[model samples]
Target chain A: MTEFIPPATRWHTLPSPFAMKRGGELRDARMAYETWGTLNAARDNAVLIVTGLSPDAHAASNEGNPEPGWWDAMVGPGKPIDTDRWFVICVNSLGSCKGSTGPASVNPATGTRYGLAFPELSVEDGANAAFEVVKSLGVDTLACLVGNSMGGMVALAYLLLHPDSARAHINISGSARALPFSIAIRSLQREAIRLDPNWNHGDYDDDTQYPEAGMRMARKLGVITYRSALEWDGRFGRVRLDSDRREDEEPFGLEFEVESYLEGHARRFVRHFDPNCYLYLSRSMDWFDLAEYGDGDVEAGLRRIRVDRALAIGVKTDILFPLQQQEEVADGLRAAGADTEFLPLPSPQGHDAFLVDIARFGPAVRNFLSSL
Target chain B: MTEFIPPATRWHTLPSPFAMKRGGELRDARMAYETWGTLNAARDNAVLIVTGLSPDAHAASNEGNPEPGWWDAMVGPGKPIDTDRWFVICVNSLGSCKGSTGPASVNPATGTRYGLAFPELSVEDGANAAFEVVKSLGVDTLACLVGNSMGGMVALAYLLLHPDSARAHINISGSARALPFSIAIRSLQREAIRLDPNWNHGDYDDDTQYPEAGMRMARKLGVITYRSALEWDGRFGRVRLDSDRREDEEPFGLEFEVESYLEGHARRFVRHFDPNCYLYLSRSMDWFDLAEYGDGDVEAGLRRIRVDRALAIGVKTDILFPLQQQEEVADGLRAAGADTEFLPLPSPQGHDAFLVDIARFGPAVRNFLSSL
Candidate 1:
């Protein structure tokens, strides 16, 4: 059996809400988080790196068998985030399969896994959970809150809900509101999970076979949007899969390097991710809306923010979160009397540029953090 | 039933070798073509507009229903092609269902549909067929041969096979070789058709099902690549299919504009196209490679071309056939001593720009044809 090392961190419990926006209620809610570096006497050097849809507190730190964190390149000792300079904190939000109290967590009332009984999590609720994590960390104010994709949504929510909580915010490859096309793609991914016969209506236990097929399908669909078409074509136009073909046989097959890349991504993702979590998180992303909380006046809502600075970074080829959306975020922040910087990075990686195009992104982020 | 009207002019058949590279023999193969406008006494006023993968002889002249032809904008009485001065001919190439001997055509010996017995066609075969059509039109030489996508591949083939056939050639949004990603996508589409329960190993003629599910899936996949993510996100993001929902109950969900758009496209295509035909055409496209025929010397093959001039047009957002491919075509033609013009049309519609972005494409094509 593999040895399990408990996280060298503390967990924080949040006030239970009866019902969430999408229905269902929580009896006892909690969040998992980890902190790095040290808090200054004024507690002003805190930097919160919010986790994506399924990520946990181990965002900027190493985990299991000396493997580096997802954002290690941007966060480590002398890197962009610079753990040596700032007290970096990451939290596992509600409705996640990590150490947080999610569908996989045991329910106090039922004495069983919450499963589908877990309350649906909105971006605001996720932010609220993170807020509790921050308070527990003994931090009164944060220097910056940096997030990517769904985490960006959470960061935006934090800026809206607790204006004085952070001095700066970085929203990377995220939008103010989910677009209709995104909703459609997310819906399909959710349906792929829900429709899987092996899902057993989300009742499968840890020991049971997970919805691998559904997860694989969802990952495949996600991969399509995560990269640019030019990247796909340039990397792998109509190429043969196998070189040895029987005489008189048609050799036309998925021979392209892009197809193999996409397939590998799907296969690897399915191995670690839960199908139910995929559906829940995708739906939450689709429903995320900053204007909704601000009564539909996006500018007015942003004006209510009390942050000191904002940084919006967009990838040029990211169709999911276009550069225009980032410009809107910067415009909103500037209008709110907050100093804002909008950087559009050129990359062929599309929406996943933040994760893959480290060469270009690392220095920009480092400069931004240093300026802050 | 749809009304069928014969062309005002008579058709002449030109002889071609029926034997394909795949070892199948199509005995007594002939190419049928229609010519519009009068040929000059010297017969040097000939122009050829190669139709797309499925289009037939009716490329640009008015037809029975008084509908302008497929390329009516650039080839009318007083338009760019100038029917008053130049003779234009369009042919139905081999391995197509448009008045051509495709899988659906009856075999002379068996008195039945050729079906899977149809020979696997190559880009060279398509060019050879076009050569026959040009010869049958009684044109000793062509002033120009214009083609798009698959048709562009044929034009390249023509340049390699019959170096002195045309003075100029236009290859729009096409590549000298099929990219690996394109082949993989085509393979998946073919697999969708082949795996359908109703496919009956490509022999389900009597079954009325006609692989609708498989075809619908294939079309959905095709539509995703046919357009760009930017276009889809800008047009359809996450809009719901239904605006009204019953109280206290979730309505049958059909959310997201992209899904609805793809579904509509899939449904409409299924009504007209055969699943088997889709498979055959996709495979043909996947296998197309000018380098394979020119002994893998693309530059040398292009240098052998005797065309006096060439025009290559590429759409900015055409991921399937990007602007770089068109640039390569122009460079090749220029290297061969042909006066070449490379025009990159700006559009967000991706590969479908040629069909939809008429405002931009029309003027460019008009200018080129007028100059010719």
Candidate 2:
């Protein structure tokens, strides 16, 4: 069945235009994506991979680059995703700072950075953009759509809006709607960025730093919430960072091991990610409500997802989206008369389980894909 | 046996030099405290109450002010504390700025605010100051000592340092040492305050507003931690605040109900609380290690506690100090051969359960006091 295959890495400009869900339009909107393996003649072997808040088009390592992908352990030659057998396409999400058209992109309307002028982005818009990229690559009906965290929500948006587009779906640690606790945590992150005097309402000059302090605080908070306290309790405990720092020297640098851990990730993220893009994407996640699509009914919302097969993977310790949310996905898919599998994996990683729990999550994903 | 009731609101400066645990001494060391009811002729009926991080000497509505105190519901004349029978004394801790000498206090040596130059403070120093206040009030021994959260940690310090100073001890939602999760949270809070450009390394002008924005962010984080996410989920889940606020307006203000709730408390706290004191007290809590007192053994530390009886009350939903920490206290106390009662109660509130869950926590305190 192997036939037309897109280039390893390429861009797809929307055939028509991207009509944003919340009243906006993106003309000449282009989606950046990468492909592995071959698309069958019938285009039925294509597997779409959507990423979480901070990832890009890179998912698994390929011949072009030997460096491992973000999900290299889960999506490689003999990996759970099995690029050898399945054609995989991972798209950098719209409104992202990756090599995609986002707020960082020059606005065709003004020829300058969109800055705060970027239109309101929604999960549906991201899905539509990704769909356009997949269609341009000659993939008709997707063999499987696998998304984790924010990616899971985008997959749902795609499935609900275009009921028969994907053959199967795998949602990992995602919710039908963002929870209040998650929303509050995100609001604080946004506030941290905005409160920085340098942010200037997301209109900072090109010469100066772009609210790095606020971004650092945001990333620090995100790191704390993404992983469970139990994981950190045993790992870092009350251990000091530097034993030879001479404690009596006014103490300004990182003191505890956990602080150093958080700062490391935060500093790295603040350097690469854009603050305006972060604000836009975070609000879009909050604005997502599948129940709204079902006319104020949850069961009806689930019933709209008309996939042939689906898998909902939930982590017991995932505070962002608990097991109940995954259960809702299973219940919803079943209500839509779709064959579904709900896998509940317990791990100390919390919402981050999908990112690194290869042992527990990998086998299940492989089994699901093989069965499909 | 009732006689000689201490003044309702008063200050007591130790006649002799007061020593701190780590080093140095306060030449004019003074403690501010409030009391209710009469002391017995034998001074055996005196009850001491230690406060959490932000509370002051005012525990209930007293003679000086008829208004309700922070714990007015639990410590009234005929309330659970039963001021009618036992002499109740609430002392502001050593590192607190509320009616106590803290970083905001003037250093006699420099004739300026202590600021970062304040001597290193530990839980033991706070306990020593509180004990001195009680001793100066003509009290030979306390009938009981009640503490919650940070206060609970201080109570353990006092009990271990002066074995026979109190007949009974009640520790609510506290641990022998600050856990990693708690330490991480406090670290972020201190970082928030310090990162604020207006903060000037704890040397900000006294005339200007003191890093209120940073303090607000820190307090908001504290409020989130002090209660369970499950509690917020049911109460303020994804609901928009002030529908009147236009959707297109710049969102510098609160948008979610949880944000409003947190911002309200944070704003109130930033006005009254000193940022430097918060930093000092928070670090002091993280530095508290009971094992240090016991020559590096938890059981040996508990064995140093010479109290006749003790009670540890823990809320099941408390994430800051989970049930395991309270269990550790009970286990250690029993290992030390002290008569101890361990009660694990369920509440939606997390660490703040002790402050507001009077219905659940009140009867236990009253019963424990009556039995003692």
Candidate 3:
């Protein structure tokens, strides 16, 4: 087995052009990932951490970047997904601008940005790419595969697409399929970008940030839906964002504290994320449906997932992937004769509870993996 | 009292330029109203029905417009409002475009469309304008005042601004104040309009619809949030809008029935509504705070509402004005010493339940008015 030395940042280019499951192909396809801790001699002590649509492979800070990772609280030397024991690899999703081959990448055919020419992407493709990453890392059998949000869906897709490839799987705040409600939300985000006159049919160039306004609005809706209104009301009930404004007066700037918070976060997101990449990734999410695995029978799809054990964790307040969807995952797996543990965590952050309230969400994940 | 004759459609201009309570004025301020049934010899028998945003005086079909009104299912000769027994008056809100003097009207000062030049608006201004319409009609006392959505907020404002003018008040899907959540939703809607390059700062005119795309996107979001996901899942459930497309493929045109539904409605709205009017009325809603009546005290706002009896009906699944806000209305009324009835109706229609599933939401209104 290869000596296990955790790498802070690494890139792997597929030997050949990567073909997509749905349609199209990515030439010069590359994968970016970050790892923590040391891999054991057995090559079995590896855990794959897949991310949501926006997060990069930098899930936790390392020597390369001293800054904390997105899941800094949950992944550390001694915390859940402990690096001291298992090698953890978080890979930037395919079709994402964050250090991965995406729409922003140059097309090998025309030597221009892919833009709208990017092929239809599916969660299965992301899953397959992740498997390639694992293989390149010399890990034959993963100790556990952990996914959150879009990552979770990809993890589930990996199980069904490559049956028996994983030892176990853990899906957090994810559903077997993207329900119509979610599809509608994602569709609006894409429409926001496409409708912008500045978007120029996604061929915006000259280093100009096209359709920033539309993207900002899209992120605003995203942030609002990410957290429950209960949390917003509790944290900011009509509290003014800027104290200098007259109490009864309305201004062009933001009024409520919540609006300011949403704007600030969206602004940051807009600066780092590319619009075309966002469109492709979002549409891929909407297209992801595991039922295709079982030929329309969800139970059959679950049966195809050959793992020693699996776990599905849901948050009660997660409207995106509600508890019922998570429950359906467990029920399907149990019906398929798989040893599955279903845990429901109550949180105020809605679909974002996994990332925000890690304290409450982590223990369930830690315990389930520990049990295995 | 004037003779009880239900006129078709009529317009009444205020004796003077109508000044807004918050600031700004409408030149040649006029209100359009349609009445049904016969006003009893005692003017006290008139019941005023104020409409939500985008609707006109055509609450129900009349001779001028033979088609069914937007609320045809809920109001008619023998419908819940029971036009046969009581004189029903539905008025176009102050800043709407259907018939009333609004942003679409020529500004007497500039001889141009008011557009953004129109003064800041408030729900109180809408209420006061409606009061003027009632006075011009020679109705001294009203049997009941019913308002839905933005109209509901105006009804509450009317009860307080013109204390005791309405004998009984009914607020459906309306709150004493716009919550932070609703404010955020409205803010995004306004941003959609403002961000549209074609919007031209709301100055586009001369028989052209300005910023139609932005309005369409805004309506898309509006339709999504106005109903419960459960309803969409039950009714549409990823059903293809066009079956000719490949089962696994995505199309540029709408693919899901829900998307088609929202687009159809938004298309119609775009054709009929003015963008500036939408901005004005939506901002008016955001600015309205019944607590302003009680000096920033919500309960005091309820107390300032000098009504003998009141009713607040909420949809169990309404996300726009959640049941909790509806409950607050009832609780405040009770604390204010009013004989109030709170009806928590269950429906999958959410905030639009009153307009969509009349069969389920009408009885509460009917029974309450009948009891009064």
Worst 10 residues of 3 chain A by lDDT: A1-10
Candidate with better DockQ, 1 vs 3? 3
**Pick by DockQ: which candidate is best?**
2
lDDT by residue (A1-372, candidate 3, tens digit) is: 011122466888865679998777887888889988888999888999999998889888877767788898888788888888889999999888777788888788998878888887888889999999999999988889999999988998887777667788888888887777787888788788877666677777734747787689779888877888777778877777557742334333466777778778888977567888888898888777777778886667767777888898888767667788888888887777778889887787789998889788778877876787
- Best of the candidates, lDDT: 2
For model 3 chain B, give the 10-residue run with minimal summed lDDT: B1-10
Model 3 error, position B84 (Å): 1.0
Clashing pairs in 3: none
What TM-score goes with each of the models?
A: 0.83, 0.94, 0.94
Q: Candidate 1 docking category? A: acceptable
Q: Tens-digit lDDT track for model 2 on A59-123?
A: 87777656677888998888899988899999988888776778777778787878877788898
- Per residue, candidate 2 scores C-alpha lDDT tens digits across B40-145 of 8889899999988988888888888777888988997778999989999999888777767788787777888788877778888899899889998898789998
What TM-score applies to chain A of candidate 2? 0.95
Report lDDT per candidate: 0.71, 0.82, 0.80
Listed per model in order, the count of residue pairs whose N, CA or C atoms clash below 3 Å is 17, 0, 0
Identify the candidate with maximal TM-score: 2
